[model samples]
Target: MAMRKLKHKQVPVWIRLRHLPVELWTVKGLSTVASGIGRPLYPDAITRACTRLDFAHVCVMLDVSSKLPKHIIIMMPKEEGGEITCKIDVEYEWLPPKCTSCMTLGHMAKVCAFTKPSNPAIPPVSVLFLKRYLQGHHPCSRLKGWTNRERDELPHGKTKREYRRLKGWTTSERDESISCRPKRRTTKERDESVLVKEG
Candidate 1:
């Protein structure tokens, strides 16, 4: 076993938070990001777990507004035969699961995926997003093409008037026909009625 004294620096943001509202999660080892670029000499598993990064290795400054812990610990490569464990300590905002059923995050009862009618807990919002992702159908607001109205005019969206137009229907002449006085009906019907009364 080799141990060397490394230089430690005070945290940057810690000095600023005089005490607003914070729950710190302290881990005891360096992140996999550190070792991936240069090996911390820990192991493989540690590298995989700690190096789970999103947004192109950009340090995502998590918002601490959620009612979750504000700290996290990252584990390093586990030593063979379970001897050495590299614990990475991280201090940041943790978004705790506001959901009581699954204890997950960014979800409500209406949108949890893990929830079933019988054994339901989490909201189904996650499921909805998943379905939309799989279907590859985005809302009209998100689309970039001509737009819903234009697309509707093209083929898919057909209303009564639109359907009629597709069927080659035009304005009917009968609909525009006008009523005339008929020249007082030639006065013949009136004369005939008078003769019948005389008979």
Candidate 2:
């Protein structure tokens, strides 16, 4: 028998595109252009229509049953009076969490307070030192890092905050296991309301 080659099946772009329409790195450009700034069109059906119709207005509409973006859709509208009207989309970059130290994100460690002018590398020993100084029972007392200067500088003063943490010792404080119990007495004689005649 003649040697036969095992053929690998090729998935069409249409099938693959149905799963992931764009690659990860491609989003930023898509976001800028999609927001209406001009750029190169994503090679899709809309481009061919614009080429044929030569219509000044063209848009790359989306079928959102898959709901990639729940609320917004990108539209390419014609400029009222401009030479270049072709539009593109750049994907948005999601803003990252703010650094309490440096107050910005997208980058950390490089620009953070722990490495900046006032701050230096936070050693584990610095935290143990703060725990010794603060005299706090807070879980954060065990946290590692230099204490925020404001926290370390608080004036020695009596605060309602201190008393709130301690249990009250008065008998009224005991209510002695009371919320679970019924206020009414339980005995049969007590269950019946008592009346006294004034002579």
Task: Put down candidate 2 lDDT per residue, 56-82, tens digits, no spaces.
Answer: 222233321222231223343345853
Which numbered prediction scores highest in TM-score against the true structure?
1
Give lDDT tens digits, candidate 1, residues 1-199.
9996432221112111112111111122233333222222322342235443221121232222333233333343344644333333333323333445555445665665657466648665677566544333322222334222232332234431211111111223676432332324346544444211111
lDDT of 1: 0.31
When superposed on Cα atoms, how far off is each prediction in RMSD? 23.4, 23.6
lDDT of 2: 0.33
* Model 1 segments more than 4 A misplaced: 1-84, 100-104, 107-199
Per-residue error at 142 for model 1, in Å?
Answer: 75
